[model samples]
Target: MKVALTGAEGFLGWHTRVLLRALGWPDPVLIGRADLADAAVLADRLRGVDRVLHLAGVNRGEPAEVAAGNVAVAEALARGLRRCAQPPKTLVYANTVQAGNGTAYGDSKAAAAAILAGAAAGCHLVDHRLPHLYGEHGRPFYNSVTATFCRVLADGGEPELRDDRELRLVHVTDAAAALLDAPPAGPWDAAMPALRIGVHALADRLAGFAATYRGGDLPPLTDRHDVRLFNTYRSHLFPAGYPIPLVRRADHRGELVEAVRSHGAGQAFCSATRPGVTRGEHFHLAKVERFVVLRGRAEIRLRRVGGRGLVRFPVDGAEPVVVDMPTMWAHDITNTGDGDLLTLFWTNDLFDPARPDTYPEPVAAA
Candidate 1:
């Protein structure tokens, strides 16, 4: 069957394309759009499409800007669907982790979801609300903790951890697999409603894989990532009602104790700016990491040679669980909170700058 994908060249979009192909689906019609809100342009490219995978939006930045981006995209898509003489079989929107919160990004995504939940029957719609996304096709800066930490530690610098924050994660490949295997139409099913994985354990497991990954001079991105990238300090480890866990420098220790203490002989650390801050814009050939949102909110973005995409996680400032970053992706952390976000930082093993294994990339021409 044929499918139409918006954000075809993006991280998640591109991965989804591969998964579709693996599932025996034909070449899906790729509907590439720079902005999601532009219905006229989107609709023009959407013709003759069987399904639409909406995976475009600003991961982090000003609240107004994020809300505008998300709301406009969904509204425009809905409007476009109405204009279709024969709507596509279904629509699967790649939603962010911050969908239920009051944050601009979260609220906006939630609003967009409402539209998808009630889309016209002829044009079926389903919201693929995903957690932290990491895989081989990710950017160096924001793919996952595995990717991020490997780079941070690869340079042999002690990572500055967030202390507290809880989050979730998932692998791009697994996410892609899930997407392609998803049932068509709206009203997500429990079997395939939406999947959430833990990035911490995922990272540790991959770290085990890395111990044996002695490939070329570059790094090795692997499959499998958790939704909660790290152990978020939940409740903003500080005195702020931002929902993030209140935290301190020592809280970092506690974060690791909970996330990776069981790994034995290995350690985990975190490195990402508070909400509103941008961190990654590169990639790795054989690295891995796990991101944990301890407090506030943030967006993790990834871009690679072939594609890119952004994902939002509304923390309201709290503790993180963990998310894994793989080598095949580039990464960066963007904090999205009004208060100082408390992020739990950890790593899989002792850093090795001498054997530094990672790569880099850029966001746009402009």
Candidate 2:
């Protein structure tokens, strides 16, 4: 089913997007706030979408600005849904966990819910409410407790607790899956705390999850067998729901660099692996790249920022050719063939996020 998702690049939203795709839904009309002032324009843009998941808001903002910005976006989303020729079957509102008359963020969300409730006709309105959500994508606040504790512990400082700590915690992927899986809520489920947890326990739980994750190997090490990967130092957490790049097969295993590339930029090497192996969900910018399946087979998928209709290629050794991909197009190469698919890659420049390169975006739907 078609859907409209806001804050598509943010932690929760991206997880939700990934979940929806996993559930066999098409890519939703992923949107980031373009203009809050023009509610009508925004609404018109949202018109005729099947489902609109609103997750745009600031947890920490000047109370007035936060309230106004949030209320405005809700108003615009409602207008957009109303304008839809066929009202959406589901209009899921991603309300914060701290709802009701609690903090300013909570208060604003409660108010936004009111606006949305009024806009529904036959629309199923489900308000996904949860406490601090935790997971890989949640780097800062939502994952604040985990992030803080992890940073402190890694830096040789024990995590400090502010006595009497209590709060609900939801895994980001789990919460996102819940939102997508939540059928239109019955009237009673509106603005309800569907889930909850405590602060100290939350920290302990995350720490435990981190510790036992990937069989008690911790963050950087994927597995104990790869322990000899003495040079491997990848800290990013690949939450279960997302892609886990099969980087450097055992044969090429010893050479894994944290740096994107060593040579200038024009050179690159990617994998079209053994029939059962996969490559990655990550890509680089400023890298004029080319991919060639030297053996076996591959399914090369490419996508861009706001574009629809991914470019798909299911190639085999019988017909192997290099595909040149410009920076605007972020791509992933997979070995869908029965044998090892060796892919040759060449890049235009070295990796540099500051040079307007390397966007850590969602991998295409499998």
Best by TM-score: 2
How well does candidate 2 score on lDDT at residue 129? 72
Compare the candidates by lDDT and give the number of the best one: 2
The digit string of per-residue lDDT tens for model 1 on 83-141 reads 66677888888886668878898889999888876655677666777776654424546
Model 1 TM-score relative to the real fold: 0.52
What shift in Å separates residue 220 of candidate 2 from its native position after superposition?
Answer: 16
Q: What is the C-alpha lDDT of each candidate?
A: 0.52, 0.55
Candidate 2's residue-wise lDDT over 317-360, tens digit each?
Answer: 45544454433345677777667777766554445444433445
- Per-prediction tally of clashes: 120, 12
Positional deviation of residue 186's Cα in model 1 after best superposition, in angstroms = 25
Residue 16's lDDT within candidate 1 is 70
Q: What is the lDDT of candidate 2?
A: 0.55
- List the candidate 1 regions with Cα displacement exceeding 4 Å: 34-41, 118-121, 154-158, 164-167, 182-366
